[model samples]
Target chain A: MKTTAALSRLFAGIQADLDLVDKTFQERATSGLDILNTASMHAISSPGKRLRTALTLLSGKLNTYRFQKLLLLSVAFEMTHLATLIHDDIIDEASTRRGHPTVNALWGDKISILLGDYYFAKTAGLIADIEDPRIDHLFSDTVATVCEGTILEIMTSGNADLSQETYFEKIKNKTACLFAACSKGGAIISGASPEEIERLHAYGQHLGIAFQIIDDILDYTQDQSTIGKPAGNDLRQGMVTLPLIYALEDESQNGYRQQVQSLLTQTTHKEEDITAIVGWVTRGNGVKKSLLDAHAHGNKAREALYHFPPSPDRDVLDELIDFVLSRNK
Target chain B: MKTTAALSRLFAGIQADLDLVDKTFQERATSGLDILNTASMHAISSPGKRLRTALTLLSGKLNTYRFQKLLLLSVAFEMTHLATLIHDDIIDEASTRRGHPTVNALWGDKISILLGDYYFAKTAGLIADIEDPRIDHLFSDTVATVCEGTILEIMTSGNADLSQETYFEKIKNKTACLFAACSKGGAIISGASPEEIERLHAYGQHLGIAFQIIDDILDYTQDQSTIGKPAGNDLRQGMVTLPLIYALEDESQNGYRQQVQSLLTQTTHKEEDITAIVGWVTRGNGVKKSLLDAHAHGNKAREALYHFPPSPDRDVLDELIDFVLSRNK
Candidate 1:
């Protein structure tokens, strides 16, 4: 119960900051035109975790950084995250996200693609406003890393023989790198010590990896209703995640791999076939082991926070680490 | 004869700068990975006029501002432009651009969309490296404006009653604003006086309008062989350009509007019908008047350049203005 309360407090704080970022985005984009206002509001109001922005603000405040700079950095991080999501939805052929129709689904892939570019431009604009070339350079390099990661993911999609090293690199680029940037950038903006910045960045990086592992595990274990989408959707798309990696280790499961591969190759398969595969994975110990692995990483993430000075903000971050381990929905 | 010589000289100068910009882009994007290097080269090698980069370099040099800043700004502008074009090609369902298969046509829409985002991230990265928050803000705002313009165009397609004011606003955002930024940003980076920056901005704005108008005219007046694509492709797609605007003034041509509306409403139409509509618009006086209006804007563009002090660089600017007026392909 106490952990839930902490999570709520963190959520509310992040929500308020995101509201401010949304308002700033709207105010800057207003050209006294109704269409511009309407479109901007519609795009911004779409549901998201706002996790990237939260990481930026919370990390900065924990280090006693200036509020305004923290807000701007939060906005930039959120914009970059949003930009990638917009394009990713198109590539995934995902019609929905966060229980709402994706931009690509609602407006068609073309507008979604353009809007993604717009968000990227907005993020760049925010970075440029900071007036520090070092921050600018760091932000740009991070963006490139994210793109490279995405390309790597696309290239390796159906390759079951994908190595663990390749998987780590892909997840680091596609997920962890941005999270690391959020913490480190917040630290940079707030004038944190190099050591503190490094520690905070490590904390974010480990947390992101754990978070993605949990997500992958959920694909096998969670009910569609709670998850807000069909289970096994990733596997349906031929992406072999961690649970599948673990499940495929047994020689008996070699037949199971062939079944999954046949479904993928056919480009058409019954949902029941996917459900059977999900059941098989669940009956096995893979999901349980993946969860244990996630917990271990979550513990490591909390350990990285030890370098920071004691504060309530740091305490909330500590709670956040626990929340990641226990999150169900 | 004199005009041809001027254009030849202008193209030669632009070609040299484009080579340098291309080389720099390749060097910066290198990741010691063959796939990345190959993809970056293939994407950037796609055909374009390099107008944004050329404008940036010329504007900077026109003020006698000699620095590597122009190179950075030029690359940013070109990347931004290419990013938008990739998205635009998807939106327009265009299979060919500049007489070659579009990114979407060759790689599929999914890859095309991601590649566009890749360039956007790359452009943001470049701007971030420059470490100027003000310039970053400018680029971001410009990008947002371009997006809004594109959205507006999509929403307003086939609306025969679209006002001239709305058209100008759309073109300003979609085309002229970027050109203005190229000129003004180039000057700002070199620390030009505010007055000089504004004048160059005006020059770019007028030139961009002229350039777009000429393009619209060519859609009706130029043959497939000369223009390297089917003429009237825009009209077939239900886009009403300036020449169509002029053509619609006559009662007889009012039927042409109806034909366009009908074509747009249909899922598919006969090619003969499309060809007939193109022939009607071309034989009319509207296209001629539109060309004349384009020349007038070109003249205005030249007039805006009078604010700068005389130099050989300024002479090159004059030559570029003349080149814009005379180009037939």
Candidate 2:
């Protein structure tokens, strides 16, 4: 939680502009229908770190760019992220987000689904008005990647034999693809050199993958109240996140593999089963192995930012790398 | 059933190009995820009249244009239309479409949701490469409208007091907006005169509104086998379409209103109630009034196209105006 304050401090230079993106997003999401407006408001009104939007703003400082268009693109990326979350809640049947009831919980799954669609459309509408074909391509391709990754995750759910390669592919699609697009798109709109764009894109990729790993890790380590989501909820729901994947692969933890496998196949789990699984996952070297992976990715993300000479923007990005990996430090 | 041949004939000049749109769209909607690929292939493979794609191709012939780009844009429009249908089925909890099992039925709501999103992203990817901001603007704006419209429809599903004005607004957003964008976008891409673009857009608007009216009326009038959907489906689901709105307003049908209203408010409806409502809708002036409304809009659609000098494309469009309003003729 202290890392959030650190993350906020990193955005101090561009706080006002980030707020503008927030204001613009809220103001634009209204559909003029009462129910839709209510649902849309509920979705955007929820507290999010807005990390992706911040990345866009921070990246824009690296070069000369149209400030308003950059903000719009940033909002576009945030909206797409929000869109995915709305659908994700439905897919997960999640009851809360940021400690507030989700759109699916407040409204029904039907309205939630449509509101998710609305956000995706709203994102496209934002970028479609921008003249940069590269940004358009990046945003749409990222959308494809996100959806494809999610569908793959859904398809592979409950399989204990899922590989590390497949897990990386899934998380990259569901999380890193959009992050890569955010940084790359910001660079493109800023008229950065092609090489710089590629570097930032790679930076965002590593950062996003590491970020998701921390998220899954925190699901096991953090309190349910702190995360605003049920702890080990993924395991109970038959989802195979990185932590569980590592536990399954650890020879040292093989004693509990059959127990975890049996729990995975169970459609209904006792609360005790979840507790036992979490205990084993934490006690094993799985969490350590996962953290080691995140550290490596965090290092790679920092290496990608080496292209930019020291500036406030690059410094802020470096701080974000620390923020993402700060769980250990 | 008879209207099918006439609608196809309306695309006579662009039959081959329309086929190319179909082939291109089918080839492109695949996401390489086996489940998504199967679902998408199922969606595109199901027999659709492909009227929206035809409209784009026909509208392009109003002036000389970049032929392949126009075809691609047509495919883009069709894909967007299909994306909306996929989401709509989930919202409706529909089991079948066009006499075939829907993606939702085959896979589940979760996969259906992602596949629908995949199609939307695919459409954006197609237009993002087109090098035209107008096409991008049209595509995204239409997406927003379709979603907002559907959300509004979902919110108002059980309300018996829905107004005719609201009904038209809903249909315009849900259906006409995409149709309007298709024609207008095709004209923009083809470099048609502003007047021609406006005329075609208005034509599409009127045509789409009438098309939806016919769809509602067919629910009351057509056989289950002919329409591929259950009769009185909208009424059973508590949807008050144009015919129902007209029936409720009819002075001669005053007695049925109380009974109909009661039935609507019930969460689970009896088939007898659906039968009674459908009988009243057809036997009363409801279907007549709805058909009369369709005819008026159909006439207006035809009038918009009169601004164009007669050509094979123009003739085909004129025939479409008839196809939309035709029930028996």
Number of the top-ranking candidate, with lDDT as the measure: 2
List where candidate 1 sits over 4 angstroms from the true fold: A1-6, A11-19, A25-40, A46-48, B1-8, B11-18, B31-36
Candidate 2 Cα deviation (angstroms), residue B72:
1.7
Candidate 2, RMSD to the unseen true structure: 1.8
State which candidate has the highest TM-score.
Answer: 2
- Candidates, DockQ: 0.61, 0.79
Model 2 Cα shift for residue B276 (angstroms): 1.8
Q: For each candidate, what is the lDDT?
A: 0.75, 0.84
- Which candidate number has the best DockQ? 2
Clashing pairs in 2: none
Model 2 misplaced regions, further than 4 Å: A327-329, B1-3, B327-329
- Residue B264 of model 1, lDDT score: 54
lDDT for each residue of candidate 1 in A1-329, tens digit (9 for 90 to 100):
34345566776756666678767766654544465455456666765446677778778877666767777777777777877887898888898765677777877776777677777777776777666676676677777787778778777787666666787788888898998888888888778888888988898888888888888887777776766678888778778777777787767778777786675555666889988888988888778878888888888888898777788778767777777777765
Q: Quote the positional error of residue B211 for candidate 1 in Å.
A: 0.8
lDDT of each residue in B1-329, candidate 2, tens digit only = 55566656666667777778778877887766777777878888776547887777778888975678987888888888888888888888899886888889999999989988888888888998788877777887888888888877876777778899999999999998988888888888889988999999999999999999999899899867887888988887778899999888877768887888888778788888889889888988889999999989989888998988988888888887777777442
